[model samples]
Target: MHIVITGAAGFLGQRLVTRLLERGRLDDQTIRRLTLLDQIEAPVPDADGVEIVAQALDVTVPGALDEVLASGPDVIYHLAAVVSSAAEADLDLGMRVNFDATRALIEGCRQHELAATRLLMASSVAAYGGELPEVLDDMTALQPQNSYGAQKAMCELLINDYSRRGLVDGRVLRLPTIVIRPGRPNAAASSFASSILREPLNGEDAVCPVPTDLEMFVMSPGKVVEALIHGAEVPGERWAPFRAFMLPGITVSVAEMLETLREVAGDAAVARVRHEPDARVTAIVSSWPARFDTAKARRLGFEGDGNFREIIEAFVDERP
Candidate 1:
């Protein structure tokens, strides 16, 4: 089987690549070729019996995906997108990359004329917004307040319709904010979530952009990679009725995350986080529903971190 991962240089894509290499198979088929595509070439592991191809290409440029899809991937993990704040800051860039590029990839799959190909897209909880149920469920309607979420929601519909037309076997995982990402902060409004813990643990002062009381729906990177693999392996019929659903996650307040940090790394680490609110970020982050009735995800075999403590500890242990 050949697998193609777009945005393969990003945090999640890189982890997913490592996990796939470790397993050596997806949906019971041996992965013989792994194609990684992004704006810059991604790093690949040296593994026996697997051919690795990493390239730097813009998906939005005409014929960009055509060149990649010619490799004929059996499965595609679409993880590329302009993040929340960046998307909001530049409408044209967001629409070009998030909307146009995504559409091109899906259409490129259709043009492949393959019998079937699995498409696993990384959607976001940002897809839900405005007045929402205290705990969002599978049945909640999408009313995205941000450009990033709106683009993802739109792509979900496209994937569903394309799947219905027998163009591709697609599934959308509406992910919670992935916490404790290791690295310097990026433009994502949710970057603060990881910054609060990651920076402080490294002995650097970090800024808390939102109120301490603000709540967030979060998942650890380890669990999300597991969810991605599981989502790819599930049979098509099991997800036929609906191609999109939320992944399970824990609801943690800003205060709760800091408390967990204190427990894991002591008061000095917790003390490094400073409360300096940013209204723009707070608006975008707060509009998302923090609590979710993810019985559907749980029933479907997706899992999340048991608590914030595990999330922090996992970060400490696994990060390079």
Candidate 2:
């Protein structure tokens, strides 16, 4: 299979590329070729037997998608997007990068391979909005409260339509706040969950923007990769040709997250955390739903780690 990963230099993107190699998909016997694209120059992690050529190109530029799709990869993992905070702060840039850029990818794929290709979109819980209802089922309607959420919801719709028209096979996974994320804190409001743990582990201070009681959903990069690969391999007939649905994950409160970190990393790591809430951040977080029925995804056999403790352990194993 020819596989291409956009945003190939980002934290999760790099990890996914590594994971794919570990899965032995990069071996020349299994993969025909591997292409990596990113906004800035990036080093391709050493993958034995895999032919990987990378380029630094801003995807927003015209004709960029066509260049990336020239080889017509069997599967395209579209993970490039502006963070939630950035989208909220800069509406125009958000629409340009997060929305328009993605549309370009879809259109490019449509123009190149038609019905022969598949796309896996990395969406977020942010796609949900405005004080999550008591319960969010697959049938729930989307009412995004932030520019980022609104952008993702609209993209899901376009992806579904593109699939229906046989432009490409598209599957959407509403990712949980991938816990144990390794990197500096990003603009994502949910970054605190990983930041509090990551910073403290390095003997550095971290901030908690939301109260301990605040609850939200989360998962690890391991599970996120699993969900994406599983979605990619699903037979086109397994479900109808076009349906963008939620991917299942676990939910926890800030207190729950910290407790799990303390248990996994001990009091020394926990001591480095500081709480300083910003009302705007709090209000945005408050509108997020902490849990979802996820019956559809669960029934489909997609899920995350059993507990946050496991998530914390994974973080330690990777970062420490």
Candidate 3:
């Protein structure tokens, strides 16, 4: 099987690539070639049997994906995006990269006549906003309140329509905020979710821009990668009628996360977190639903982190 991963240089992308390499197979088919694409050149992994091709390609550019798609990959993990805060900050940039690029990929697949190509995209919970139920579910309508969410929601519908038309086999996983991410924070509005815990554990000061009681549905990096893979392997018949659904995640408040940090790393680490609110960040973060009824996803065999403590422990144990 030939597979392609966009945003292969980013954190989740890198993790997915590593996991794929370790398994060396997908849907019981041996992975003969792996093409990694990113704005920057993606890292080429050491795979004895698999051919690895890393390239710097801008999907937003016209015809940029032609050469890549010409090879006719069996599966494509479209993980590239402008992210939440970054997309919200730059409307044109967000629309171009987030929505437009996705359309380009779908069209590319259609033009290449690769109807069997499985395009698994990484969507965000930001897809929900404004008036919302206390607990969202797969049947909830998308009412995005932010530019980033709007862009993703648009892509979700486009992919669904295209899938229904038999142009492409697509699956959209609406992900919760991924917490305890490693390295320095980026522009994601939820970056603080990881910062408050990650920085403190590293003995560095971190800021919490939202209220202590603010709740968020979150998944760990490991679980997100696992969900992506599982989404890819599931039979296409199982995804009928709808190609998008929320992935399962644990819901926890900021204060509870700190308590979990305290349980794992003591008060000193918790003390490093200082509250200093940012209205923009808070508005975007607060708009997303904190709880979800992911029964559909659960029935689909996708799993989430058992608790915040397990997520914290996993991060601590995996950190160098």
Provide TM-scores for the models.
Answer: 0.96, 0.93, 0.97
Measured by TM-score, the strongest candidate is 3
Candidate 2 per-residue C-alpha lDDT over 1-320 given as tens digits, one digit per residue, 9 for 90 to 100:
88888888887778778777788653233765668889986677777778887888888888887866877788888888888888988999999988999999998987786576878888888888764568788877888888998999999999988888878888788887778788788777677788888898777899998889988778888888888777777755544543666776688888888887788778877778888988877887778877788876776668778987888777677764
Per lDDT, the best of the predicted structures is: 3
User: Which 10 successive residues of model 3 have the least lDDT summed?
Assistant: 81-90
Q: Please list the C-alpha lDDT of all candidates, in the order they appear.
A: 0.90, 0.80, 0.92
Query: Which scores higher on lDDT, 1 or 3?
Result: 3
Q: What would the per-residue lDDT of candidate 1 be over residues 12-61, giving only the tens digit for each residue? A: 99999999999999889999999999999999889899999999999889
Error of 3 at 149 (Å): 0.9
Local error of candidate 1 at residue 85 (angstroms): 1.8
What stretches of model 1 exceed 4 Å from their correct place? none
Candidate 3, residues 1-320: lDDT per residue as tens digits? 99999999999999999999999899999999999999999989799999999999898999999998999999999999987777877999999999999999999999999899999998989889877988888899999888888999999999999999999999999998998899998877789999999999999999999999999999999999999999999987688788899999999999999999999999999999999999988987888898999988998899999999999999998898
Q: List the residue pairs that clash in candidate 3.
A: none
* Root-mean-square deviation of every model: 1.3, 2.1, 1.1
lDDT, ranked from best to worst: 3, 1, 2
